[model samples]
Target: MKPLSTIVQAITGCLLIISCNHTPRARTVQVQSSANESVKDYPSHPKTAEELRQELAETEAADPAGMLLISGTMQENKILIQKPDLFHHSKYATDGYMISGIIRNKASIAPFKDAIVRVTFYTETRTELDHKDYPVYKYVLAQQVTPFELKVYPPESTKDFNMEVVSATAIRN
Candidate 1:
């Protein structure tokens, strides 16, 4: 029989792999469903565009980040992480590391400019260590990609990290 500790480690590793493998499409579907529910629960309809704007403003005031994204016209972006490399930079800080990756615009034709890309570092136990957001270049053109490099100076106690394109302004051509 396998040792208890070894079995536990294997199970933990499997769970981590499963959690990290969520596709962006699945996440978008989830967000759309949740947004649908929230919109269904909104009390009234606005007669004018200005009133619609006011309603959105009030909703955003209630849930600053989520409501704006849900009510906005922007579509979900597929920011693919390509060739991500993380390396330890210092011996003193347990989470001292540098990460470099290429973020590709996989699923959009609507050009986005100056989007905020965020990385959240987590410990082995899945505890949040640190998070930082950086702006992409002036524009991430349609069907193209951008390379980025960032260092986590004081990563606290990170063992893993997740990168995301959190927010971006979509521009019409």
Candidate 2:
């Protein structure tokens, strides 16, 4: 008996003569990207000063709280409040550890004046993702300058938790 390779070669030779014009196609695979929490890759969307102000106005009406939700597009660097200096350790079980950060609004947009910020955290639960088992933290505008919201998670003993910020509508009207 002939080898399997020889048989396959004969079959290919037949096809090659039949379709002499058509070239052999290449085989490849493309896999989709998996979701990773820590890997935060934000796309760049350039916005003019005027456009930023307009978006700030629209977002103002949309949410009563002036929370600058980090999004893929639209908002500029000013809209985001990232505390790189602060550490976020998810894998570790941090009990009685106080994790805090500030929720602030962009100053470039004047319409968002006095945008009061609100903060909340969710605990890692068995049945749900962000369970409100943790304490509900709140903040109201008390002064001229923006300050960080500092408080302990779970109020007593913090397990794995996530942070959230809600900025009240800056519009005084």
Q: What are the models' TM-scores?
A: 0.42, 0.30
Model 1's alpha-carbon lDDT is 0.56
Query: Candidate 2's error at 118, in angstroms?
Result: 7.2
For model 2, how does the per-residue alpha-carbon lDDT over 68-142 read when each residue is reduced to its tens digit?
431111111122234344585333333333333444444333334333323233334422233232222343232
Structural RMSD, model 1: 27.1
- Give stretches of model 1 more than 4 Å off: 1-96
The most accurate candidate by TM-score is 1
The TM-score, computed over Cα atoms with residue i paired to residue i, of candidate 2 is 0.30
Q: Summarize candidate 1's per-residue lDDT along 1-173 as a digit string, tens digits.
A: 56998999999999999989966764434334554464435657637876665554444333312211211111122233444448533222133355666655543234456667677778899888888886765565556776665555536466677767777665543
Error in Å for residue 12 of model 1 = 77
